[model samples]
Target: MRVRIAVPATAANLGPGFDVLALALELQNEVEAERTGEAGISVDPGPGAPPELCDPARNLVVRAYTAACAELGAPADGVHIRCVNRIPFRRGLGSSAAAALGGTLVAAALNGAPWDEHSIIDFVSGLEGHPDNAAAALLGGLVVVTPGAPAVTMDVPEELCAVVFVPDLELETALARRVVAGAFTRADAVHNAARCALFIRAIATRDWPTLRWAMEDRWHQPPRSALYPAMPELIAGALEGGACGAALSGAGPAVIALVAGAPEAVQEGFMRAASRCDLRGRSFVSRVRNFGARVDLSA
Candidate 1:
């Protein structure tokens, strides 16, 4: 038996929503898994996938799959999985979350295990040590992950899209998070809280103009700026190029801008700004996907 699943890329924190909010993107990573006769685990990192992803024991997809198999009371070994990775790893695009979700979904499909979506989110969150990214990947669209409650999810309008700038660099989440001082100032807390609420409201009401200020953050982005000194310029360019709002995507090194339409301007904005900073990078536009993880095929 074989199973194939697809999981969407996610952008977390959307500015002040730190660790509480995220949204899914159209970008996806796919996984194919099947039981093998051999008594061992095997992983194939598909074309363009880095060697880092090919490690059977360490690859996130395989680990997640193995965990799910154990949960189903099935053998964890004797399984082969091939990962076709589109989301860039370690770029704060939730590639790890996607991998885990896809793998788990494939496992459940292969084993015919009864599973629920919420539980999947909970499971993946446990693996990733955070809820925002996996929650968005599980529920899709814009989500507010609340404890002891279902995530508040909203569907994005067809017109709104995201412009992403990815530098030829990787920012470790641990390193980026380490820069933040453990304590928060009352003023900063108040500031981020208000902006976080306003951002949700702006998206809910489709009040695009207010997003210019709504996406402001003081919690993670400010402290993270030290790592990506060019962040300010990239955001400035996106805004000047007509984006409603722009901010660091997840931890650092990459930036995401929300725009109403005609993403070309924002795309160029990212490129031009990166050039000015001498930051070698690429830019692309992606839709805010409403659908989350799904089984694409099984046999």
Candidate 2:
């Protein structure tokens, strides 16, 4: 049997929520897995991607399949997987989650579909060691993970635009986690909680001004900024260029600008700021992808 699955890259912990509040972006990855009698895996690389990404064992598709076979009793023998990857790695994009979810979905579908959505979420969460990106990749749109019971998700305004700035260097999530403080004061927690609530409200209502002020956080960005020395200046430039709000998009390296209506203006501002710093990299002008992961069994 053959199955094809697609998952969108996520921008998680939007601002201050830390382990919650993930949003799906327009960037995506697609995986196709077919079951054969052999006991190996192969990946067909996407265009312009490095030659090494095509290796099955090193690929996330193989990791997902191996993990699923170990945990779900699915047959990993003779699985040929191919990936069409569009998301950039280590740029605060949920590239890992997208690959894991896409590969898992393909594996499960090929194995006669034993797990439900919630079960799949749990499985991927375990594989990724976190739920923020997995939840968004699985559920789509805006997902808020409660960390205890079943993860819950809500559909947010899809019309909102997100301007993402991807710097040249890679910012590893593991390294970013190390820089965060071990604990926070009760007052600080209260502050972030209040702002998180307001941020969600602003997202639901599509209120730009509310989001601009409500999304600022003291939890992770401040401590994490030492790695990216130009963060403050870049953020300030983004705001000056017309972004309503900007923040470290899940760990760092890439900063997402929340713009109300003018994406071009935001991009120009970000470009101008980068120019001033003599930095060069790729930037994405995209909007929220309300629809998360979708599979077509009929195909």
Candidate 3:
């Protein structure tokens, strides 16, 4: 049996909603897995995929596949895997989430085990240590994840586009996360709470002006700015370039601007900011993807 899976890229923690909100982007990574009737795993890494990822023991996809099979009490046998990775790893774009979802779905298909959205969410979130990115990759659109609660997904505004500026330098999530403070003051907590509430309403009502303020945060971004010195200027440039809102995407070296106008304008704004900050980066213009991971079976 052969299984193919596609998972959308995700941008998590849109400003004040740290670890609670994420959106699926049109960028994607795909995986193809075939049962080999053997007892080991092999991989063919696609374009832009790192050479080290070809080793099954070191690969997230192969690891996820093995874990899923164990959970299902299914035979863990030979599987040949191929990856077509468009999302850059460790760029705050949920590449790991996609790989985990792709591999788990492939394993479930091969084992003929029934799977559902929540089950996938539970499994992947357990592996990822957070639900925001995993929920967005599995369910799509704008996802709000809270601990001990089912995630809620909302449609992204049709006019809104994401202008993502990805730096050439990579910031691993572990390193980025280590810089964040473990505790917040009451004022900081309240500030983020109010903004997170406003952010949801602003997106729902399509209130661009409100969204601009709602996306501001005192919780994560400020503390993290020390690590990505160019973030403040990049965010300011996006707003100056007519974006409704902008923020550091996830634990980012990559930033995303939410714009209702031409994405190119925002892209250019990011370039200008990069120039001013003496930073080098690439930009992508993308729309929200309303659908999540999917699987297909072929002989």
Task: Write one digit per residue (lDDT tens) for candidate 3, span 120-220.
Answer: 88898888888899999989999999888789899988888899999888887887777776746789889999999999998899887887988998888
Per-residue alpha-carbon lDDT of model 1 for 117-202, expressed as tens digits?
Answer: 77888888888888889989988899999877777789988788999998999999988878876746889999999998999889
Report the C-alpha lDDT of model 2 over 134-227, residue by residue, as the tens digit.
8888887788888667777777675678999888888888888888857467877888899899988888788878877777888788778887
Candidate closer to the true structure by TM-score (higher is better), 1 or 2 = 1
Give the C-alpha lDDT of model 3.
Answer: 0.89
Candidate 2 clashes between residue pairs 3 or more apart in a chain or in different chains: 38-78, 140-292
For all predictions, the C-alpha RMSD in Å is 1.4, 1.8, 1.1
Query: How does model 3 score by TM-score?
Result: 0.97
- Would you list the C-alpha lDDT of every candidate in the order shown? 0.87, 0.80, 0.89
TM-score of each: 0.96, 0.94, 0.97
Better of 1 and 3 by lDDT: 3
Clashes of each: 0, 2, 1
Off by more than 4 A, model 2: 48-52
